[model samples]
Target chain A: MTRGSVVAAGTGLVLGLLALGPALAPGFTLAYDMVFVPHPVFDRETFGLAGMLPRHVPSDAVVTTLAQVAPADLVQKTILLAILVIACASAAALVPSERLTARLAGGVVYAWNPFVAERLLLGQWALLLGYAALPWVVRAAARGEPRRLVLALVPAAIGGFAAMAVSGLVVLVIGLHRPRPAGRSVGVGRSGVKRLPWSLGALLVMSLPWLVPSVARFSGVPADPAGVAAFAARADTPFGALGSLLLLGGGWNAETVPPGYGAAVTAVPWLCVVLLALVAYACRGRAAGTGGLGVAALAGLVLASLGAVMPGLLRWAIGLWPGFAVLRDGQQYVAPLAVVVAVGAGLVVDRVAGRRPELAALALLVPVALLPGLAWGAGGRLAAVRYPADWSRARAVVTAEPGDVLVLPWEAYRTYAWNGGRRVLDPLPRLLPGRVILNDAVRVGTGGRRDLRMAVEDPRARALDPLVRSGAPLTGALRARGVRYVAVDAPEEFAAWAGRLPGAERVVAGPDLVLYRIPGATRSRETPISQWPIAIAWFTTFAALVWSIRLPVGSLFALSSKEP
Target chain B: MRIAVAMLAGIVLALLTSFGVVRVITTSQQDPVVKPLYNYGTR
Candidate 1:
């Protein structure tokens, strides 16, 4: 294809995606349950508790208690905004002359990036919108305009601090690739400070959050050295050891690693390696061109590439992150790769452009030409649904009574578990003024397996279902602690437990769960954040489908593409 | 002329962005954490 033809095609593709994403993401979410739904962003439990329940955060932990308001449910909203930010950033990438080629290349690479697709679809807009600022910063660096750097970084300071940190690395690599001052020395320059990208300061700010908060979170709590050792042992696989550059392209994030910083770095090559090779061949005629620059960034990116996957280094880089003491897993380091991909994209495409005739057009068209970007978006939306146990079934069973306590077990007693509105007996009861919650760890035997150790046999610590035997101590604890509701995972022994109490009465039972009220215990309603509404929604939707009632086909909903 | 054009464009973009930002804050009234997620002292 002619250079201009490719450019036009790419731009057209971006425009097309810009329009389609908003409508498609939610639709896909409804259809083939996305993988992320169960796994969730941030705290999956919080998503269920706040969004499905009373739409609020409970004053439970020091972290949640510290919030003036619950952390903003930014996912669905983030997806909606991703469209706007992508469009705006795409426009920014098509900037002034002289640097127009690099900007076009950056835009082209960004449009097709899977990591960017993740941001667009997964509701990680806080991180995505942050990457949108990269192009302007690049343009400013290309022009050596300090004012532009300041202007570009101000938004990062307010909106995308983490994106700034991860993507900032890309800007540095690109700046190094820039045509420097004619007489510039190795380190020192006109003013004496190293000539670093001004955007780097803002990026430093972004990484600070990941680093600072993590450090503070762990500083007070000493590492379970055994836990860290187990994590290290688990890193035997390529996915575990974190050696692959491609793995970094997954959008790094974890309790242990920083976010998307690595994906941005690695993704640039996936889009450009072939094109870079083509450009290197295309540049056979050029005097001094981007082929060499591409090679340098490519090589540097590859060396740093392993850093994307080998998050073990991230364990050491803990010095740079928030929790210097406690090192988490590979997931957290994805941010660096994301930033790398974003900025590296600009350079890789720039290399391709520098060597080709009318190269700008090709770079512009690159992302649009890659059909996978669309599929990537769909894949992410469907990811949110992969897990089924996202919403706490136990939480949903309770009727919204303030002081009413129900006993439910968390251990693996697979069948008929999570009967409505039942709290487990020991720990929960221990917190109450007169209630005693029967806990496997405390009253019953610890360990997920069943064994009756508490009552000469707590029925936990050995059997497949620990809570099955927990019924005895649970009933006894419910009596002694004056608990009213026994929210057990509805099973055969529940009747036997209830029978032992003189005044026990059955209060509630669902298809899977059952609740019993003890005698002389005060009556109390269930919790508001209980899973009732979700249950109702499921039942209502199922019933409607059985009768073939028309389901709402919303335009605004996001959809996933099966083809991609 | 370029300065004026940039200024006008900036203002328009700012207004549009403000509208977008407002749309976000208005609709996303939810929490991102699970409750009793960790019974730390007890566990």
Candidate 2:
């Protein structure tokens, strides 16, 4: 890497750490599923990996292993910081410029944009990891070197399927740039066709871990209409959509917008668009790479406008396969566009700095000045908190009495005081381990729909709901299904239900959480599925990773042999 | 060959340095008593 790229990356890393500030002190942002709960990675029964694929498995495994050596919270924080650095470094590498100031400015914008800030607040670390690796994938594809291609897959493997998707898109864009041969008509498309095998092989190898499981257990569970709407891009006007994409600011949830944001914030996006246009005009035909990135940015914007522009089409495609739900949050498509804008802004900076060196400092300061709220956890939207001591004590109590525990007021998301007022996945299942049942309902939907009912159709979880609501006594029917302990976190909602547990002994009673032991509850029989697919996926991922490493090293040996 | 070696080495270095920096920063800082910005139940 050039010195300019190194400086840009270094500056971005320092700023990112500073931006996180006090949040990093906790070592964990207990905002969402990123709760500091450590567990074995391969528990298919508890995780329910039989019917679906979790793209975060590789990252989860890494964090789980890291927890053995360090505090899980610390490990989580480290991962977040690493992601930010990678994002900045990758963007810096993409800037085809010699100017240090311009490169630094680009890295800052790419790493600390509104899109990244919103996703971070939402606690989508896995997605962010994938987003961070995008520029590297683009860089590798542009070069089309075998060693570079292998290097690109490293991040794709670690980031999982989402990164693989982005990498695939980038590779396709690079392939489009393949020029026609000088004179031969037959060889016109031959080179591009020949390169197809390598490109496809790389994508398949990188995505094998997630792809194998998804294909093997292809549950065509369609997303709910409300979920699709809730996550859809909310840019009503054409200019508004373009501005939002440029600013990286089109999150569906209004709450995700910085607390004190006003009209001034809207101007920032427009300014970014204007700057990018001016840069494109100035550098027209001068930079071939910029043209490809511009095309990518335009494509990303169109994809992001899917539901917003044509709701019926988006919904229709989603109905064809549940996998299309990945596009539900079309706003995430802004990631590549953000990279393009960052690089364009850097080129603009480079041009201006060449004429007036004094203006370089001003260019570097533009990103910070424009998006100040994003710097400090999007105005506390991404604040970190330490889980209460009682949570750990409750986990121990549940662990001592070994049986399947059912969390009361059973819901997927919970707002915990311990998690800094952030709504997060109920940590009980991960904390206590062993078939801990919780409601996995998709409540965000219109009145009645089959697709929306998929997650909520858990008979076991659904059976407990009415019984708890009626404050009915726990009978043998409920006990046989393996709900041994009733863990109630929100007492106000379920106190009456807890009062109805017949012959139940209070294990760990606290203000925030209470655990009740069922007297006659027994362990439910578990039917284990064939583990061959999981084994194959894991084995293939490991082998591919090893082979990727060897490919580059082995090339050096080949070079030496040729020299001798 | 040298460029390829440097690229690989740089990746490893970046990964290690990031890990080390985060660990050191988080561990060295005093743990702050963070209060919930708003009531958790209201959300």
Question: Per-residue CA lDDT of candidate 1, range A1-564, in tens?
Answer: 324224423443444344233333331122110111211222312312221111111111112222324332223323434434443343323321134444444444544444445344333344444455544444443333344444444333333334454345444654455353452211112121233544355344423323332222233332222222222212211343333333333322111111122243433444354345334323331112211223333443443333334445644554354333223322222433333343444444445555662554444444433323333223222221111231234333332442244445543112222211111222222122222233333222212333222111111122213433544445554445445666555354455555544455655555444556666655432232434443453344234334322322111011101111
What docking grade does candidate 1 earn? incorrect
The regions of model 1 sitting more than 4 angstroms off are A1-84, A87-102, A117-126, A135-216, A222-365, A368-376, A379-564, B1-43
Give the TM-score, chain B only, in order for the candidates: 0.60, 0.61
DockQ of 2: 0.05
* Fnat of all models, as shown: 0.00, 0.01
lDDT of each: 0.34, 0.59
* Candidate 2 lDDT, B1-43, residue by residue in tens: 3433443354344344434444444355433222221211111
**Angstrom error at residue A170, model 1:** 6.7
Number of the top-ranking candidate, with lDDT as the measure = 2
* Model 1 per-residue lDDT at A176: 59
| Candidate 1 chain A: 10-residue stretch with minimal lDDT | A555-564
